[model samples]
Target: MIETVVFDVGETITRDDRYWAAWADWLEIPRHTLSALVGAVVARGQDNAEALRLARPGIDVAAEYHAREAAGRGERLDESDLYEDVRPALTELRGMGVRVVIAGNQTTIAGDLLRGLSLPADLIATSGEWGVAKPQPAFFERVLEVAQAAPARTLYVGDHPANDVFPAKAAGLRTAHLRRGPWGHLWADTPEVVASADWQVDSLTQLVEVVEDARRSSGS
Candidate 1:
């Protein structure tokens, strides 16, 4: 049975509209242009941040991010960023006695912002805090350690196939590929994603039922 549900941040528990929009504003470009470039990079399996590099060639994206922070215009998160199903679904899972963790490839600031939201989770963490990011074996290893459970009993849920599904599965946890964000919907029907995901869900509410069904099947 699944004892722990670990979620990804961007495009999983939260929408990424503000993230790309912030970049568009920072680059002084139309949001659509940067959004289109992001889609293009995602289509080609390139890093999503490649859109920023494409917007301003030879620009140091990291340096610009620090500059934005220095300028008091870095990442921002509020309740508006979360999906509608996030609160109720997470609360219900916790109520059901399942451990819920929010772990993703986000920055330290984002982690702080998320904690400020007071989402119903056991722990919230990010790559900036852990010094490891997704698709890396070490990242999933940390997730398993944080879970405090056997990998087989931990479920790692996210929208990205490469970063979420494959690596988490390789790390021995059950994988749930959520079909919500761009990467989620775009690769939802791909054979590899279908094969890699132990559970393919469109929303967090549906994920609750998955865990419930698992419990029944396992007689837990």
Candidate 2:
């Protein structure tokens, strides 16, 4: 049975509109241009940060991030940023005795903001705080550590195939690829995603059904 659900923050439990819009505003570029560049980067299987570099060549992304913070404009998160289905799905999973964890490649500030929102999750963690990011075995190791469950019993859910599905599968965690965001929809039917993801879903609510079905099949 799936005893724990570890989630990726962006485009899974939360919508990333404000996050990218903030970056575009900080860069003084049209939001559409940055969005297109980000899509291009994702299509090319490059790091998403490469989009910012494309916008401003030779730019130090980390430095610019700090600069944005110094100017009183940094990563922002609140209830509005969360996907509507997140709370219901998490609450249902927790009610069913499943541990719900929110872990993703995000900044410590984003983690703090998420905590401030008081999401219905057992834990909320970020890459900045953990010093490891997605597609890293160590990162999945951390996830399994916090999950306190066997890798096979823990489900890692996200929207990115390469960063979320492939590595989590490599780490022996069952994965669910949610086809909600750009990266998700773009690669939803690709052979790699189809082969790697244990379950493919369109929403968090659907994930609840996945767990229920697994429990039923496992006689848990």
Candidate 3:
């Protein structure tokens, strides 16, 4: 039986356009420019961090990120950052005795911010804490450990196909692709990626259904 549902943070639960547009506005960069930079990096199958380095050459991206984060320790993500479907779906899953958790490639404060928002996730884990990111085997190992759920019985849901669907499937978890974020829509037409996921959801309403369908189809 599937005992746990692990969700991606940024795009899976949070709305990307709002999140990134605000980020672009703060950095004094045009939203289209920022989006293109992100697309350029992802198009070549590179990590999201590469976008910043490419956008502003010769800058110490990591250092700048840390400095900004350190200065913004008090910053809280606006409620609007979250998708409307997130809470209701999480609530229903938890009510059904499924362990709902959040795990993502994110900064250290992702846990604090998520918790502070009073999100329904029972636990939140991050790449910062693990010192590793998704699409990496070590990260999935940590996810399995922290979740204390077997890979075969865990449902891993995320918006990015490269980092989420493929990797989670390789890690032996049931994979579900959420098709609402930047990466989600960007790679939607990629046949191999679409075919790889055990489930594809346009929204969390569909995501809830995917989980139930997985149980029935897999007989787990």
Candidate 4:
């Protein structure tokens, strides 16, 4: 049985509407241009680091990312940013004795921001705190450790194919591709990435059904 539901932050769980725009503005690129770059990165099955190089050659990606973070790029998240279905789904999962965790590659400030929202997750972990980020197996490995879950018994839900679905699945967790965020819609049509997800949903309400079906299929 899948005992833990690990969710990607930023766009998957909480809506940090200011984030992408902030990054784009910092890079002196229009938000639409940055969005296009993201789509191209996803279509090519590339990681964010590579996307950074492609976006601007000879650029210090890490330095710029930190600069963006220091500026509070989407650092302020609240209940208002959450989709209507988020809390109910989380509550339902917890009530079923399932653990819900917000696990994602986010800025260091994200931990505090997420915790402040009281989103009903049993744990909230960010890449900054872990000293590693997604698309790397190490990140998910720590997630499993924190959840005290076997990889196969965990379901990772996210909008990014490269950063979330593929990497989490590679680490042996079941994957859910939630289609609404930029990466979700941009890479939605990418054949292989879409095929990698064991489940896909349009909303958090649909996630409950997916979880139930998965439980049945797992015979637990």
Candidate 5:
């Protein structure tokens, strides 16, 4: 019946990639290099904290990069506008009787970022707060438990295939892959990757309609 809709914060609900660009600019490294470093750390089976430790060089550079980028961009870097369509989208879903929630990997700084963007604080569920990250089945399980929703009745929308689509599908929840912007590179270009998802949409505005179709097909 799609009673609950869970979202990822960073790239899904918020424009965090710009921050990644800021990080890349600060570190004076190509964004792809930092991404590769992060992927290598994860491939080694290290948790987020350990991965952060292993990727400290890239992380440190990214931090400095963001500081300088923020300084240089000034008002242009303001993310307040990012939340413009987000709230309206959620409101539309909520009006359809869907329970909106967030399941994301974020640190404490995420709170300030959400507040600055005027996102509703109560809608968030972060790894920093829950002590777990995505690509782990337990993370989705925990969010389902908190939302009091059954796997079949929930939908998870995210950007990454491994972290977002695969895990959510593994947990038995329908997944919507948001493939907007340059983040499209995160998906595998094979048929298997293409066939894994229940739905794929290029924009968040398309999500509500997808869910509606799922509901109708399920005869809910």
Candidate 6:
């Protein structure tokens, strides 16, 4: 049975795509260029530090993007109501006797952002504070260890294929791909990528059903 549901914060639990979109707009660069830069760095088989060096320009863009995101902190949006469902979903999962943990590539700012959005603060288990990042296998391993969760009894949910699903599967955890929304553009048309996920959902609401099915099958 899936005893715990681990989530990626940025795009999975919250609608933070505006950060990326702002980066692309601010850099005056195509979104694909940013993607290529990041992908090339990851493909180089270097450590995260080296990847960061290769991706420095994009990082600068990201800083500017975060500034913009921070500036509009209290403005709020009607469509942002999508995020309101997150806390209740987490509450329901906890009520079902399942543990909830957030595993994301965020810095200390993550705590503030979660608080600003009124998300459950206690659920976060991030790499930024832990000094790691996603798709690194070690990151997920750390989260599992910290959460006292076995790989087989945990599910990693995230919006990115490589960053979320790929490494989680490599670490022996089941993965659910949040297929809709802005991150959809990150996916490539490849058979391997397409077949990587154990389950895929277009919305977080759908996750409730997926978890219930898993629970029933496992007789939890």
Task: Please report the candidate that would top lDDT against the real structure.
Answer: 1
Candidate with better TM-score, 1 vs 6:
1
The positional error of residue 80 in candidate 5, measured at the CA in angstroms, is: 4.1
lDDT of prediction 5: 0.68
The TM-score ranking, best first, is 1, 2, 3, 4, 5, 6
The prediction achieving the highest TM-score against the true structure is 1
lDDT (tens digit, per residue) of candidate 5 on 1-220: 6888888876677765465554555456788766666556545534433434444534563464356646774113245536355777787888888888877877545644565665542466678778888878889879788767888888888877777878888899888877743343446454644787777877677878977887898897
Candidate 6 residue runs with Cα over 4 Å from true position? 21-84, 185-190
lDDT of 3 at 3: 83
The number of clashing residue pairs in each candidate reads: 0, 0, 1, 0, 1, 0
- How would you encode candidate 3's per-residue C-alpha lDDT over 55-111 as one tens digit per residue? 677868667656656776333576888999999999988877789889998778766
C-alpha RMSD by candidate, in order:
0.6, 0.7, 2.2, 2.9, 5.2, 5.4
How big is the positional error of residue 27 in model 2, measured in Å on the Cα after superposition?
1.1
lDDT of 2 at 123: 98
Backbone clashes in model 5, listed as residue pairs: 26-65
**Pairs with steric clashes in candidate 6:** none
TM-score of each: 0.99, 0.98, 0.89, 0.82, 0.73, 0.71
The TM-score between candidate 6 and the true structure equals 0.71
- Model 2 residue runs over 4 Å out of place are none
Better candidate number, 5 or 6, judged by lDDT: 5
Residue-level lDDT of model 1, residues 1-220, one tens digit each, is 9999999999999999999999899999999999999999999999998889999999898999999999999999999999999999999999999999999999999999999999999999999999999989999999999998899999999999999999999999999999988999999999999998999999898988999999999998
Candidate-wise lDDT, in order? 0.95, 0.94, 0.80, 0.81, 0.68, 0.67
lDDT of model 5, residue 53: 46
**What TM-score, to 2 decimals, does candidate 2 have?**
0.98
**For model 6, what is the alpha-carbon lDDT of residue 22?**
46
- What lDDT does candidate 2 reach at residue 124? 97
Instruction: Please write out the lDDT profile of model 6 over residues 1-220, one tens digit for every residue.
Output: 7888888876677665454444555555676665565556545534333433454534653465467667764223234634656777777777777788877887666644555654543467567678888878789879788666789888888877778878999999988887644453446334645687778777666777888999889887
Candidate 1 Cα outliers beyond 4 Å, as residue runs: none
lDDT tens digits, residue span 41-133, model 4: 667767645655766789897788777667766345667778777999899988888899998888778798888888899999899999998
